[model samples]
Target: MRILVAPDKFAGTLSAVEAADAIAEGWSRTDPEADVVTVPMADGGPGFIEVLHASLGGELLAVTVRGPLGDPVPAAVLKVGETAYIESAQACGLVFLPTEADGRTPRPGVAAQASTYGVGELIAAAIDAGARRVVIGLGGSGTNDAGAGMLAALGASSEPVKAMTSGPEGLAHVASVDVEPARERLAGVELVAASDVDNPLLGLRGATNVFGEQKGFVGDDAKLAADAALTTFAEAAGRKVADAKGAGAAGGLGYGILLVGGRREPGFATVAAAVGLPDLVATSDVVVTGEGKLDWQSMNGKVPVGVAGLAGSALRPCIAMAGAVQVGNRELRANGIEAAYSLVDIVGTEESFAHPARSLAAVAERVAKTWSRR
Candidate 1:
C-alpha cells in the first residue's frame, strides 16, 4: 500500500517536517510493510519555505530581521534559482507576538504595538541576493497596521509621516506615502504576496474586524479606530484598496503589497505546483493530510483540504488527522476528507499536546491498521 503522509505544523508543538516524521513513525508501527510517502505541507505561513525546500531543493539564506515586537529575530529567505521566497511569518509571525517576552504577566497591551517592519527587511535581503522575483508567504501575522510597518522597513519615509504611534491606531496619521525608495531597491524585481484568504482589507470580513481579536485589538472602539485609520491611510496613498481580494491578508499586508504593485496569488496553488502534488497524488492509494486544528477554516484552502482536493480528483481516499476536531463528519466529507481523527479524542487534550509525536504516531498507526491493507 502507498500512503502519502503530509501534515502542516501542529501550531507550537511540531513543525511540518516533524509532524510528517511522527506520522510516518506511527504508520511504520501498524503497517511496517506499507509504503508511505512523507511530504510536509504549508499554506504560506511559518513553514512555507521549509516545506517547499523539502520537496523542491532550494538554498535557505538566513538573515537577522526585526521580530513583531521589534526584537531581532533570525529569519530565512529561500532561494530557488533567480526567485527568492520570503515567508512573512518569519519576520512578523504571531509566534513572535510579544507576551511574557515583553516582560509582562498575562501579556498586556502588546498586540497593537507589533509591526511588519522585519518582513520588509527580509524582502530587502531577497533583493540584495540578486533575486529578480520575490514570493512573500503572507499569513500568521502579528500586526493590524495594514503593512505600514513593512513599508517603513522598506524605506517609506517616516520623516514626512508624523503621528507615528505604530499599529492600526496611527495608520491614519501617516502623512506621506513613498514607494520610490523601495521601487529603486526593487528594480527589475516582481513582488508577489501569496495568500489563501480572499477577504478584503476593510469591513466585517476585513483584517481588523476578522483577525484583530487574536492580536489583542478587541471591542467595538478599537475596531472602529483601526478601520478609520486604515481608511485614512488608503486616502493618503491615493488608492482605495480595502475591498480588493486578499487585501485583508496578514493584517492588510496584502493591501500594502498591492499598493506597491505586488500581485496576490493563491498560496496553496503556488506551493502545490512547485511540489508537483498532483502527479504525486495520482500514484497514491491513500492520501493522509492534516494540520493542528480542523474547523470551518479548513474548507478555505488550508493545506490538508488542498491536499485532499487533489487526492479526491484522482479518485483516492483522503484522511485527516489533527490535534483537535471542531467540525462534523459530514463537513469533513464535503471537504474531501473521507475520514477524520483527532489527538484530543484518542488521548486527553493534555497528553495529546504534551506528546504530539507519540499521539500522532498512535493515530497514524490506527489508520494504517484499518485502511492501509484495504
Candidate 2:
C-alpha cells in the first residue's frame, strides 16, 4: 500500500516534517512493505517556511526584524524566481511573542502589546532582494492593531498608534493614516495575502470580537474599543475596508494589504497549487493529513481539510490525525475526510504533549492495523 503522510505542525510539540516522519515510521512498523511518501504541509501559518522551502526549492534569506513585542527576532523570506513568499508568523506570529525564559511556552499579556511591524520590515527585505511579486502568509498573528504597526513600518507618515500596548485600545485614538509613501515603495510589486480566514474587519463576527481573545484581547470592552479604533483607521484609509472579505485575517493584515492595492487569495489552495499538491494526490494511493488541533476551525479552509478535499477530488481515501480531534464523523465526512484519529487518545493526554512523536507513531501503527483489517 502507498500512503502519503502530510501534516501541519502540532503546535508546541511537532513540526509538519517531524509528524510525517513519525507517522511513516510507525506505519512502517505495521507494514514493512508499505510505500510511504512524506510531504509536510502548512495552512499559511507557522509551518509555511519549511513547506515552501521543501517544495519550491527557494533561496531562504534571513533578516533581523522586530518581534511582536518590539524585541529582535530572526525571520526569513523565501524567493523562488521573481516571487517572494513571506510567512507572517515569522514576524507577527504568537510563536515569537514573549515567552517564559525557557522559550518553550507562551507568556500572557504580550499579546495585548504585540505588533506586526517586523512583518513590514521583512516585506521591505523581500522587495530589496528584487522580488517583483510578494505572497504573504497570514496566520498565527499576535497583534490586534488592524495591521497599524505594519502600516507604520511600510512608510505611513502618521505615528503608529502604538507598537506596544495593553490590547488594541490605542487604535481608538487613530485619527488619520497615510499610505502614499507605502504605495510608492511597493510601486511595481504585486502583493497578495494568502489567508484562510474570511472574517470582516469589525463586528460581532469580525476580527476583534471573534479572534481577539485568542490573541489576548481580554474583555468585551477591549474588543469594542479595538473595533471602534479599526473603524477610525478604515475611514482614514479612505475606504470602507472593514467589511471586506478576509479583512480580518492576521488581525487585519489582509485588509492592510488591500489598503495598499494587494489582493486576497485562499491560503491552502494557493499554496497547494504552488506545490503541485493535486498531482501528488493523484500519484498516491492513500493520503494522510492533519494539524495541531482538529476542531471546527479545521473545516474552515485549514491545511488538513484542504488536503482532504484534494484527495477526495482525486478519488483517494484520506485519513487525518491531530493532537486532538474535537470534530465528529459527520463533519469530517462532509469535508471529505475518510477517517480521523488523535494522538491524545493513543498516548493519554499528558504523553501527547510531552512526547508527541512517540504517541503519533503509536497512533499511526494502530491506524495501519485497523486499515489492514479492512
Best by TM-score: 1
lDDT assessment of candidate 2? 0.82
**Mind giving the per-residue lDDT tens digits that candidate 1 earns over 1-374?**
88888788888788999999999999988888888898898889889999988988888999999887778999999999999999998888877765565532224346666778888899999988889999999888877777877877787755346333367656666776765676566668899988997889888898988987777676888777777777777667646666889999998899888877788999988888888889889999899998899999888899989999999899999999999989899999998999989999987799987888999998888878878784
TM-score of decoy 1: 0.93
Model 2: which residue pairs collide?
none
lDDT of 2 by residue, 141-260 (tens): 887777777777888755454422223555566566677888888999999999989998878888888887767566777677777777777777755676889899988888888888
What TM-score would each prediction reach against the true structure?
A: 0.93, 0.92
Segments in model 1 whose C-alpha atoms lie over 4 Å from true places: 100-108, 158-165
Per-candidate local distance difference test: 0.83, 0.82
Q: Which residue segments of model 2 deviate by more than 4 Å?
A: 98-112, 159-170, 372-374
lDDT winner? 1
